[model samples]
Target: MKKTINAPKAPAAVGPYVHAVEANGLIFTSGQIGLIPETGELQNGIEAQTHQVFKNLQAVLEAAGSDLDHAVKTSVFIDDINDFAKVNEIYAEYFTGDTPARSCVEVAKLPKGALVEIEVIAVKKEA
Candidate 1:
């Protein structure tokens, strides 16, 4: 069975997509920008924006009953590659383990002109 995850603590999707979907023990989360859920405002700077994106991802994963520690993979899209190191620094704070497979790329743009966006795939732990 497939399950959809939603959380009020994360920014609402600007497009027609669920925050996350879980099926057969795997959870796939949609890309998260730096929009603050309650204010619908984007965070400031690459450092702050990256932190917000991670926070958003964390919230969605929690809603799906998973977590960053369970993430098997992550994909990050940044508007500028120049900010890669800064983003990576913030990302490392959340993924402090052997670390998950990851891909980072520079894109021409992102929704709401966000500086960065992130998505993850995680496995549900056995009870």
Candidate 2:
């Protein structure tokens, strides 16, 4: 059976979708922007936004009984390709060891005019 996840510590979804869905042994997360959970305000700059994205991802993953360490894949969307290096720096801070397979692309825009957005697929932690 599949289960939907809505992390209380993560920012509320801007639209109708939930934060993630868990099926079998995996959790598939929706793309997370830089919105602060408490205020729903997008963070400033590529650096700050990137960090907030990871934080949001972490919250959602944890809600699904997973963490970044269990991530099998990730997809990143950014407003500017030139900010790849800056985003990578913050991304590295989150997945320091045994990083997951990732694909990043430059997009023209994001929800709430965010500089970055990230999504993940991860394995749920064993009980």
Taking all chains together, the TM-score of candidate 1 against the true structure is 0.96
In model 2, what are the clashing residue pairs, if there are any?
Answer: none
Model 1, runs deviating above 4 Å: none
Task: Report the Cα lDDT for candidate 1.
Answer: 0.92
Residues 4-73 of candidate 1 have per-residue lDDT tens digits of: 9887689999999999999999999999999999899999889999899989998998888888999999
- Which residue runs of candidate 2 sit more than 4 Å off their true CA positions? none
- Model 1, position 9, has a per-residue lDDT of 82
Cα TM-score per model: 0.96, 0.98
Q: Pick the candidate with the highest lDDT.
A: 2
The positional error of residue 16 in candidate 2, measured at the CA in angstroms, is: 0.9
TM-score of 2: 0.98
The per-prediction tally of clashing pairs is 0, 0
